[model samples]
Target chain A: AQSVTQPDIHITVSEGASLELRCNYSYGATPYLFWYVQSPGQGLQLLLKYFSGDTLVQGIKGFEAEFKRSQSSFNLRKPSVHWSDAAEYFCAVGVFGNKLVFGAGTILRVKS
Target chain B: EAGVTQFPSHSVIEKGQTVTLRCDPISGHDNLYWYRRVMGKEIKFLLHFVKESKQDESGMPNNRFLAERTGGTYSTLKVQPAELEDSGVYFCASSQTGLGSSYEQYFGPGTRLTVT
Candidate 1:
């Protein structure tokens, strides 16, 4: 079965500190990976996506993700943590061009 | 370009009742999808519609959930005889069709449903 695993349930980091949320997926084939963020009372927003080529993908809000095929991981990273960046992050894999299968999600807590 | 939108940002109802949620995808988008998140858990896929047609309904939890797209325009999901387990935030997303891998879904604010 194809599934996404986000190992961390909650993470806390000081403001200006670097952040990395781990994500590993189990899929049978090369999959379309994506990172989405849902801020408080807001809709899910696309952080970054990886279809193919150039493993490292950049997205909005100073966020970036690298797709490691060998590891079956597409972890999300940010050089600096912002208070506004604290939200629930989800890792998803698109299958058959029809729908998305999402991970359990990681909650980031930015502490000042 | 307006993003996808869902109606009744929040709905509170008793169990065994009916609730119908609506979604209006971004204009010109050919694909619309429904998802549900229970108590802030993983957002699970519910179904998919391609221009008024059901492309995939495998994700639907049970037959109590009925989704429809009118004339390939806006869409609605009706959950009849709601159960306590059905309480969650229902989300709707939309995307355009592309040749290769162009499945970027734009989501809505979501409708929070509370069943008692």
Candidate 2:
């Protein structure tokens, strides 16, 4: 079965500090990976996606993710954390134009 | 372009009552999908529609749930005799047809359903 794993249930970072949220996936084939963020009382927003080609993919709001095929991981990173960036982040995987299978999300908290 | 929209940002109902949720996809999007996130669980796919046609519905949990898309426009999901376990945030998403980059799905603000 295809599955997405987000290891960190909750993470805390000082505002302006570097941040990284880990994700791992299990799929039988090359997976279409995605990162989505949901702010409080808001819809999920696409952060970035990796279909193929470049291992490192850039997304909106100064976020980026690198797909490590060997590790079956697509970890999200940001150079600096902003208070507004605090939200629930999810990692998802899809195959062959199918619906996405999401991971248990990780909650990020930015402290001033 | 307007984003996908779902009706009734929140709904509270008795366990045995019937409830219907509606979704209007982004204009011109050919693919529509339904998903739900139960408490302490990952968001899971409920079903997918390709222009009013049920493309995939393997994710639907049980027989009491029914989904329909008429004339390939808007869609509705109805739950009869709802149960407490059904309480969750229901999300609808839409995307254009094609491969690779075109497959990116745009999501709507979900409807929170609470079964009392």
Candidate 3:
């Protein structure tokens, strides 16, 4: 079945440190990949998406993700972590015009 | 434009009772979707609506769940005879269209429904 896997359930990173969250997906065909963030009691916010062309995608709040077709992975990255960046992140995969299949989500805890 | 909006930030009802959820998509968005997430589970797709039509209801759980979008504007999801397993968060999302590869979904704050 088509599904997304977020290997890490919780990650801890100090402020000003770099962070990376791993994500892998399984699908029969080329899929649309996306990264979203959900703060406590807030709605899911789109971080970035990779449809086609240019494997490297940048998003708001200094977030970026790279799509690797060979690995079937779309990992989220950030060069510098901030206290406000701590939140739950979800990786999703979907076909065009369809519902997204999301992963279990990764929680980032920022420590100062 | 305002983002996707859902009614009743929280709802609590007894098992076997019926509950209805409402969603108002973006002003010009023609595609809407419903999703749910149980505790400690992934967010799963429930159904998809293109305009006033039901494009895909493959993920819907059962017949007790009925979704309707009249006039292609706001949408409603009625869950009749709710079960204890239905205690979770229901999210509503919308997109401009469901064609091509541009399926960016703008989500709402979600309604936390608890069936005791």
**Residue A71 lDDT in model 2?**
98
Among all windows of 10 consecutive residues in model 3 chain A, the one with the lowest summed lDDT is: A92-101
Better of 1 and 2 by DockQ: 2
Residue B47, candidate 2: Cα error in Å is 0.3
Q: Write the per-residue lDDT of candidate 2 for residues A1-112, one digit (tens) a residue.
A: 8899999999999999999999999999888999999999999999999999999999999999999999999999999999999999999998655689999999999999
lDDT by residue (tens digit), candidate 3, B1-108? 799999999999999999999999998888899999999999999999888999999888999999999999999999999999998999999987535433788899
Best by TM-score: 2
Candidate 1 lDDT, tens digit per residue, B1-116?
A: 89989998999999999999999999999899999999957899999999999998898999999999999999999999899999999999999888433479999999999999
Worst 10 residues of 1 chain A by lDDT: A92-101
Q: What fraction of the real A-B contacts shows up in model 2?
A: 0.70
| TM-score of the second chain, cand. 3 | 0.96
Give the residue spans of candidate 3 off by over 4 A. Answer: B98-102
TM-score, cand. 2 vs. native: 0.98
Model 3: lDDT of residue A108: 100
- What CAPRI class is candidate 1? medium
> Scoring each candidate complex against the real one, what DockQ results?
0.71, 0.74, 0.74
RMSD of model 2, in Å?
0.9
